[model samples]
Target: MRKHKIAVVPGDGVGPEVIAAGLEVLQAVAAADGGFAVESESFDWGSDRYRRLGRMMPEDGVETLRGFDAIYFGAVGDPEIPDHITLWELRLAICQGLDQYANVRPTRLLPGMQGPLRPELGEQIDWVIVRENSEGEYAGVGGRVHAGLPLETGIDVAVFTREGVARICRFACELARSRPRKRLTVVTKSNAQRHGMVFWDAVCREVLADFPDLDVDFKLVDAMAARMVTHPGDIDTVVATNLHADVLSDLASALTGSLGNGATANINPNAGVPSMFEPIHGSAFDITGKGIANPVGAFWTGAMMLEHLGEDAAAERLMKAVERVTENGPRTPDMGGQAGSADVTKAVLAAL
Candidate 1:
C-alpha cells in the first residue's frame, strides 16, 4: 500500500477535539479505499506547551516538521497566552519557514445550510480566496519604540516585493483560468495606500498579460466587501494580500454559512516542501471542551490534505460524504442542529 507520513499538530482549545474527529474520518476513508494508508505522528505543541516550556514549540520545531509529507494543523490560540505569541511562534513560523506562500480558502454554501444572506441567494456565494500567505502585512517587520511614554509608538510594516506580488498574481490567474467562469477579482487598496497597493496593481496588470483569456478586474478592498454580499455570483476566484485575504475569507465563510465550515491550504505551489492544511476559524476557547465545536472544517481540511497528497478519489469521496452529512441532519450547533462534534463525525463516516 502507498503510505504517507503526516505530522498532526492538534493545537490549543477545541483543536484537539476537532482534529480527533478528522483523523477518525480519514482512517475510515483509507480503510474503505484499501489502496493507500496514512501514518500520523501527533504533537502536543501549543499553549500548554508554552506555559510549561515558555514557547509554543521547541527551537527546532520547524526543522523537525520539515521531515513530514504534510502538516495537518488544527487551531493555534489560547486565552492564557497572547495571540501574537501563539500566532508568530507556531503558525506563522511554519508558513514562512516552509515557503508556503499561497493560502487557498474555498467557501461555498453547503446543501440544506442557510447563510445570513437572503435564502434566495442560494449557492451563488461560491468563491476561492487566494491569499498571498508568506509576505505582505504579516511579514513580521517593524517594532515598538519608546515604550510606555508619551512618544511611544508601534509600527507593523507591510512588506510587499515585486517577486512576491508577481508569483501570487500568477498563481491566482492560473487558478481563475482553470475555473469555469475564468474570472479573477483582484482586491487592493490602491486609492489609500499608494506605495504598496499601487505596486500591487502594477504586478497584477503585468501578470494578467500572461493569461490573456482570463477576465480580470480590480476592486478596492472596501468596495469588494459590498460586492461579496451584493453580487457574490459575479465573482469566482479572488486574489488579495495576506491581511486583506485573511479578513475577507472570514466574511466569505460567514456569508456561505459559518466559520465552522471554512477550510484552507497553506501551499507551496512548487511542491518543494509539504504544505499545511487547516480550518480558517480561530480556536474557540469558550467552547473548547463543550463537544459542540464544528468538525466539518477539520474534516474538509483533511479532504484538502488528501488532495494535496494526490489521493483525488479519496478526497472527493470524503468531501461528498461531508456534503451528504450536511445535506442530511445531525449537524453540530453551528449549523443549528442539536448534535455534538462526535455525532456529526459519526454521520459523516456513515455517509462515507
Candidate 2:
C-alpha cells in the first residue's frame, strides 16, 4: 500500500480539538480505501510553546518539515499574544520559508446546509480563490522606525514584482483551465494604488496571454467584493494578491456556509517541497475546549491534502463522506445544529 507521511501541527485554541477529529476521520477513510495509508506525527508548536520558549516554533522547524510528504496544519493564534507575532512567527514563517506561493481556497455551498446563500443570484456559489501566498501585499516589507517620537510612523509596503505576478497568474490560469467553467478573475486595486497594483495588472495581463484557453477578466478588488454578493455566479475562479484574496476567501466561505467549513491549501506546486493544508478559520479561542468547535473545515482540509498527495480516489471518498454528513448528519454549532465536534466526526466516520 502507498503511504504518505504527514506532519500534523495542531496549533493553539480549538486547533487541537478539530485536528484530533480530522485525524480520526482521515484514518477511517484510509482504512476504508484499503490501498493506501496515512502516517501523521503531531507537532505542538503554538502560543503555549511561545510563552515557554519565546518562539512559536523552534528555529529548525521548516527543515524538520522537509522530510514529510505534506504538512497538515491547524489554526494558530492566542488571546494573550499579539496577533502579528502569532501569525508571522508560525504560519507565515513556515509558508514563506517553504516557498508555498499559491494559497488555494475552495468554497462550495454544501447541500442541505443553511448559509448566506443568495437565492436571487440564481446560482450556488463555487469559487476557488488562488492567493499569491509568498509575496505581493504580504511580502513583509517596511517597518515602524519612529517608535517613541511625535512623528511615530509605521509603514507596510504592499510590494509586488513581475516575477511574483507572472507565476501566480500562470498558476491561477492553469487552475481555471482545469475547471469546467474555464473562467478566471484577476483582482487588483490599480486605480488607487498605482505603482504596485498597476505592476500587478500589467504582469498578470502578460502572463494570462499564455493561457489562451481560459476566459479571463480583471477587476478592482472592491468591485470584485461587491460582485461576490450581487452576482456570485459570475465568479468561478479568482486570482488576487495575498491580502486581497485572504479577505475575499473568508467572505466566500461565509457566503457558502460558515468559516468552519472553509478549507485552504498552501501549495508549493513543485515536486520536492511538501505543501501545507489547513482550515481558514484561525485558532478560534472562544470555542477552545468547548468540544463544540466545528471539524468540517479540517475534514475538508484533510481531503485536500489527500488530493494533493495524488490519492484522488481516497480524496473523493473522503469528500463524499463529508458531503453525506453535511447533507444528512450531525452538524456543529457553527452550522446551527446542536452536535459537538465529536458528533460530527462520528457522522463522518460512519459515512466513511
Candidate 3:
C-alpha cells in the first residue's frame, strides 16, 4: 500500500472542532480505499500556544512542515489576538515561508443547499478562484514610522514582480487547460494602480501568449464583482492578485451557499515543500466548541489533500460521499440543517 505522511495543524477556535471531524472522514475514506494509508501527526500550534509561547509557531515551523508529504491546516486566528498579528505570524507565515504561491479556491452550489442568490442562478455558480498567494498586497513590504503621532503613516505597498505574475498566470492557464471550459478570466485593476497592477496585466498577457489554446478575457476588479452575482455562469476559472481574489472568493462562497462550505488549496507546484489544504472559512470564534461548525468544507478540503497526494480515486470517492451527505444526510447550522459537526461527519463516513 502507498503510505503518506500528513502534518495536521488544528490552529484555533473551531479549527480544532472541524479538523477533528475532517480527520474522521479522512481515515474512513482511506480505510475504504484500501490502496493507501495516511499517517498523521498533529501540531498544536496557534493562539493557544502563542499565549504560552510568544509565537504562533516555533521558529523552525516551516522546516518541520517540509518533512511531510502534505499539510491539512485548520483555521488560524483568535479574537484575543490582533488579526494582523495572527494572520501574519501563522497562516501567511507558512504560505510565504514555504513559497506556496498558488492559492486555489473552488466554489460550487451543492445539491440540497440554498444560496442567497436565486435558486436557478445559484446552480450556475461553478468557478475556481486562483490567487497569487505569495505576493501582491499581502507581501508585507511596507512600514510604519513615527509612533504615537498625528503623522503616523502606515504604508502597505502592493508589490508584484514579472516572474511572480507570469508563474501564477501560467499556473492558472494550465489549470484552465485541464478543465473542460479551457477559459480563464484575469482580474486586473490597471486603470487605477498603474505601476504594479499594469505590470501584473502585462506579465499575464505575455504568459498567456504561450497558452494559445485558452479562451481568455481581462476584467477589472469592480466589474468582476458585479459579474459574479449578475452572471455567475460567465466565470469558470479566474486568476487575480492576492487581495482581489481573497475578497472575491468570500463573495463566491456567499453566493454558492456558505463560507462553511468553501475549500482552499495553497500549493507550491514546482517545489518539493508540502502544500496546505484548508477551509477558507476563518476560525469562527462564536461557534467554537459548540459542536455545530460545518465540517463539509473541511471534508472537502481533505479530499483536496488526498488529490494532492496522488490518491485520485480516494479523492473523487471522498467528494462523492460529501455530495451524498449534503444532498440528503444530516446538515449543520451553517447549511440550515439542525445536525452538529459530528453528525455531518458520521453521515459522510456512512456514505463512504
lDDT of 1 at 338: 92
Clashing pairs in 2: none
- Residue lDDT tens for model 2, 238-274: 9999999999999988887789999999999899899
Kindly list the per-residue Cα lDDT of model 1 for residues 14-129, writing each as its tens digit. Answer: 99999999999999999999999999999999989999989898999898988889999999998878899999999999999889999999999988799999977747887999
TM-score, per-candidate, Cα-based: 0.99, 0.98, 0.99
Where model 2 places Cα greater than 4 Å from the true spot, the runs are 120-123
lDDT of 3 by residue, 187-206 (tens): 99999999999999999999
Q: What is the lDDT of residue 260 in candidate 1?
A: 92
- For candidate 2, the lDDT comes to 0.91
Task: Name the runs in model 1 displaced over 4 angstroms.
Answer: none
Cα RMSD to native, each candidate?
Answer: 0.9, 1.0, 0.8
lDDT of each: 0.92, 0.91, 0.92
Cα lDDT for residue 161, model 3? 87
Residue 17 lDDT in candidate 3:
91
